[model samples]
Target: MAEPVLAAELRQEAPIPLDLGFALHPGEVTALFGASGAGKTTVLRCLAGLYRPRTGRIRCGGETWFDSDADLWLPSHRRRIGLVFQDYALFPHMTAEANVAAALGHLPRAQRAARARALLALVHLQDFASRRPAELSGGQRQRVAVARALAREPEVLLLDEPFSALDRAVRVALYAEIEALRARLACPIVLVTHDFEEVARLADRVLVLEDGRIIAEGDVGAISARADLPIIAAAAEAGSVLDATLVETLAARRLSVLDTAAGRLVAPVIDAAPGARLRVRIPARDVILADRAPEGLSVHNALAGTVAAVEPRAGGLADLLVAVGAARLRAQVTEDAVSRLGLAPGRPVVALVKSVAVTRPGA
Candidate 1:
């Protein structure tokens, strides 16, 4: 495992009881994911030095930002962190260039302008540098905010619901921007978001928070496969994320063939050239489990796997985790179907999925 660039252990009793510990490594994006009032923002605040927990310690890049036992504390400005808020939080009177330049206080005054312009260009907002927040579109404004945050050359980047304010189209565009930024930044990025799609699209790891506590922590696939968790079960679209590489595209059929750890998968045509890597989402509800492979079916994919777990949910539904080689697939079936199929741990099964049901994470 890579060494953690940012590590924190925080505890508090009032306002919202929180007891959480996690670490982020260089170039890793760890998402603090949960519904509202889940202490996601509080954790971000604690890391940024905006909110001090009653007890615990925070360390980043070999520096102790907070140490309760040692009576050590660092103010927000003293800690090198880049934070992008949901509202953009740019000065209304200042142009995009000025706003980004304001964060270059650590550099010599003569160098601030050049660095600011460079950062703006990094975010593809160089042409909009003279526009104020009100004069720019939501997406452009967000790009400026990201540029401003990068101006600090922070050791860690903190994003608090940065996409919640934007529409789906804009959010999708920003998702690509963030992915591009990730390639250029070596800093650990922490994102606080309630959207599972956001977690699927950008996060390398997920920390599932519930009522001020982290109930689960793991990679996106593992966490999403745990349908037993209330948060996972309650998601509008509960699914497993798979890493696949496009092998072929049947343009006429409007389908794409991808190879995954589990097996070959056929998904709706993805707008990418062959050999392109992609993250695909397989919703639990769309998966159909069969004791053996069916001879003829409309399903385009049937992956062989063994049952790892069977979690019974309310409404006569049961969630099954099927271990398909090194990958896992989540399926939701009726309890009666489970009994009829004799589904249990160690049982071999075939997971049937239609091409239309499988999709790219942010598609």
Candidate 2:
């Protein structure tokens, strides 16, 4: 494995106990997800030098950004970190180009304008360079903020709920734009979001936090498969994220077939071509459990599997971890259904999933 580009261990005294450590690698988008007071943003701020922890150490590309024992701390302006805030903090008086140029103030005055325009163009805001913050749309303003952040060519990018203010369609479009931007930048990106769907679509790795501590950390697929995480077990929208390769496109049926470890599954038509790998999220609520080989059903996908574990969840529901040929899937069934079907560990069963319910995240 490659060494992490950003590494930190942070601790705090009050308001919510903070004792957590994590690392971010280059060319990777790591998401911080949790409840409001779970210390997700705290970690981001700590890394950006906005919030200094009582005792901790932070390193970026082998350079020390903070070390409590050594009495070393880099100020926010000194730290080569780019931050995009939830509120698009653009200067109303300055045009989009000027805002981006502001970040390159350290450079020579004559070179700043060209660098600013280049950064704006990089974020697809070339034409909007002269527009003020008020004249631009929410998504456009956010893009300008992103360009400003990149103007410094920071070692790490910090995004704190940057898209929460936008509508779903705008957010989705920006997600695609950010993905394209990631391909051009080599720095590690840290995103703080409460939306699991956003995490599924954009994050390569996930960190689940609770009570100011990181309870689980892994790739999106593994982390979303975890039954122990409260967010997965308790949320009605809980689901397992799967990484599958597109094998075929059925234009007649308007569906796309993906090859997963469990089996071949068909979903609504995806925009990508065959042989492309993408993330699919199967909502637990949409999954149906069958005790016998299901026959005559409208569902398009059914995979034979064994029940690995079952746990009673909040709201009188139960979460099942089903193992299907080395791939684990989660199904949310009722306690009544579990008892009537005699569901338990080591029991043979089948998992039925609706084609429409299978979400092609970030599509």
Candidate 3:
């Protein structure tokens, strides 16, 4: 694999001790998630040059931004990074366009406004260009902040709980917009968030941190399948992310057939053409176990598999990792059910999943 666009090895002593390292590839979104004081924000600060680490190396696109061993440190302004803070930090007195224009101050003053307008259009806020932060809605203000950050055309984008301040409805809308932005921009994006829903929908890879150290790290499916991570298992949203290709679309029934490693599965219709590949999330809670072949059921997908592992969780619950061919699916069931059904590794089983249970692409 090619070198990551953003690479960092960070260690700090003040405030909270942190020792962590990671690499971020282009066009990928890596989320840092944990409880408050888990050092998520600290990592972002170090990457942005806002906090110099006690010892570490930070590189962006092969450019050395910081190297404690070499006694090198790049100031925030010198490092090319676009940061969107939790609070939409727009200039209160400036219009949406003006706030974006402020970041383009290096350009000719006359050209900044037009460039700002173009960016606003890119973010679907062309009509709100003239409105000030105070006059605009929370979502519109955030769009302005995103535009302003992109005005620098940084090599990396950093988002720190950017949607936490917005209402649920508005946050959902921004989530789609951010995903759209990711498609248009090729830079590596780092997001800091405490919301698991946000992590489920926005993160291409997740890093779970605790006490200033990484407790778990992997793509969504791998992380979700591991029973050893108490942090993930406790969420109750643990599940697999399957990469599949749309093979057929049943327009009348509003369903699509996906070819996956586990087998052919049916799901709710996605707005993608046949042959297009997409990721679908299946929450462990949504899966059903059947020792025998199920019949007279409305569930659209049932894959034959064997029990791979069974883990007991709190509250008399158990998680079963089932291996179907080359793919693994996690199912959360009550401990009583496990005992009644006699489930364990090497046991034959069938996994039933509803068509609608398949999650949307970011999830």
lDDT against the true structure, each candidate: 0.89, 0.87, 0.86
Q: How close is candidate 1 to the true structure, as a TM-score?
A: 0.93
Give TM per candidate.
Answer: 0.93, 0.94, 0.94
Q: Evaluate model 3: give its lDDT.
A: 0.86
Q: What are the per-residue Cα lDDT tens digits for candidate 1 across 189-304?
A: 99999999888889889999988899999988788887778888778778788878888999999888988877888987888888887788888888999888998688889988
Alpha-carbon RMSD, each predicted model? 2.2, 1.9, 2.0
Q: Higher TM-score: candidate 1 or 2?
A: 2
Residues 262-332, model 3: lDDT tens digits: 78889877778888767777888888998987789988888999999999988999988999877888898
For model 3, the superposed segments whose C-alpha errors exceed 4 Å read 355-358, 361-363
Tens digits of per-residue lDDT, candidate 2, 1-363, equal: 788898899888776578999899988999999878888988888898888888989998878999999999999998898999999899999999999999997899999999999999988889999999999999999999999999889899999999999999999899988888887889999999988888888889999888778899998878878887777566547888888888989999998998876678889888887888778888888889998767788888888999999989768899999998768888989999999999999999999986434344433
- Candidate 1 backbone collisions, by pair: none
The residue pairs found clashing in candidate 3 are none
